[model samples]
Target: MSVGGGGNGEILVRVENLKKWFPVAAAGLSFAAKREWVQAVDDVSFEIAKGETLGLVGESGCGKTTVGRTVARLYEPTAGKVVFDGQSIYELPAEEMRQVRRKIQMIFQDPYASLNPRMTVGDIVGEPIDINRLATGEARKNRIFELLETVGLNREHASRFPHEFSGGQRQRIGLARSLAADPSFIICDEPISALDVSIQAQVVNMLQDLQEKMGLTYLFIAHDLAMVKHISNRVAVMYLGKIVEVADGYELYAHPVHPYTTALLSAIPIPDPGVEEERRRIILEGDVPSPINPPSGCHFRTRCRLAQPVCSEKEPELVDRGAGQKVACWVT
Candidate 1:
């Protein structure tokens, strides 16, 4: 319930030096070719307090979704730790980890692809409940209907399939299913990117309401900077599989420290014509370096306008710059 993730200093989720790398086959048909690794998430560290929403924003291929999946334990972490509710999840046994899973859930992007076409809305929402053995018979049915109505869907529509509903409705069903687990922390990975503009607001508002009611913690991942600013207590900017800056929503937007964060904030358009015309956009040169073979020092230095000699020789650590704002830049 705090503004900048400072709620009694109680950390519900802590990710430390997390890394997820996938093996990429060498090009062409060669027996002796070396297999390379695509560093999707590299040494990413952050924390989400109880009842706090930490928005993770970056461009496509920035490994935001991968971070969410890794935290949810969908992908086996190549390195580092993911601690949930004071327990190290990766180190837990199978049965113990199964219990931990019920407390951590993920709402994936692409509502259509995420849901099973063969399953009805009711079945999709109730699957988690059944898996966890939370209820049965009439009790299970009532729980499903309650979840449906809670997400602003008609109880009668439960009998219908995913194809029978619109995109927004399908997303609502996804929300219902995530809630079915009675999760304490939910990773929302671009949950609204596939919906209409108006529907995006509706779903986001509903998420805020549910978080308030259920006292849930969220790691909201998305490309919508404005939306992230609106929903998140704190925002973390990622680039080239690494977090560049982390700060309070207001502080980050008003005064971005990292060069990449400043450029990203500049790209968000202003509605007012006068302000839009006067605003100076910091357009960086060069494309984002490949994660497979990132730059020597700072991954962002190749595209950064303020890149100095040291930036290419030494990678900067994420040092706190008062008021809990952390930045990984030599020049900042």
Candidate 2:
């Protein structure tokens, strides 16, 4: 399903019928070479406004990250169109794509892993500037310090190694590096998932502040529904490599139509004891089906509590139900 209507600014990113599949090869004597396609991200479509946060939520292995990577052109999509800034990203030449890269950046999930342990924090953050040839000599150093300060880090910290900093600080460094390229769009791929609960809030708030001050757009991919609700302007729920439900943040949480979206919302813990006790938790039975061979028709039908005969017989296309909400369920 897609969000309709474009505003004043040209659509910064438009993903149409995107798909990413990996081949799974059989082990043992089955080395006779049967290839099964793992549908990581299938036929997903969406558009991100010039300055908006589109939070993509799903359980692990639901291909949220794959979608972000595919859109970022980190992974060559098996099939689909990725139009960024009015140009087809996949069709662009290497040199043209390199220029586009400056406009789009990524903040990785793991602060520790994403930062190279061997490199100094200054080097780590400045690498982008150096690669882009944006600045040099004292000018480069000044730019690095400015980035560090922008992300709430002191210039002195740049001299230290990543191993010396806390997880939250490392994430700040990652943010600094991302900003060094002066990108308008950033793919925040679960940037806070690895931090402590307290640290997570700090990092998230910093990102919000940066967005406000810089007018940055984001494709936030995370499994944390509560955090997504807090940060996102709009949200998209993914299942089996497809977007099952998409709506404004408050709208989606208040009136989730898709069965899978309902189940996910039910699982989020309510702080109020009375509400927590009264809420019925939707415990989805059966494991998620393998992407290599997802179920026919509705991918969620296998475990959907409200599934009907038609759900199993035909795939539901995402249809608009008014109020800027789209759902892909037969019952909805």
lDDT of 2 by residue, 228-297 (tens): 9899888999998999999988999899999999999998998899999899999989888999889989
Candidate 2 ranges with C-alpha deviation above 4 Å? 5-9, 31-33
RMSD in order of candidates: 2.2, 1.3
Clashing pairs in 1: none
Least lDDT summed over 10 consecutive residues: which range in candidate 2?
1-10
Please give, for residues 1-332, the per-residue lDDT of candidate 1 as tens digits.
01234456589988999999999988889999989899999988988899999999999999999999999889999999988999999999889998999999989899999999999899999999998999999999999999999999989998999999999999999999999989999999999999999999999999999999999999999999999999999999999899999998899998999999999999889889999989999877768777898898889998898999999999887888879888999997
Q: What is the lDDT of candidate 1?
A: 0.91
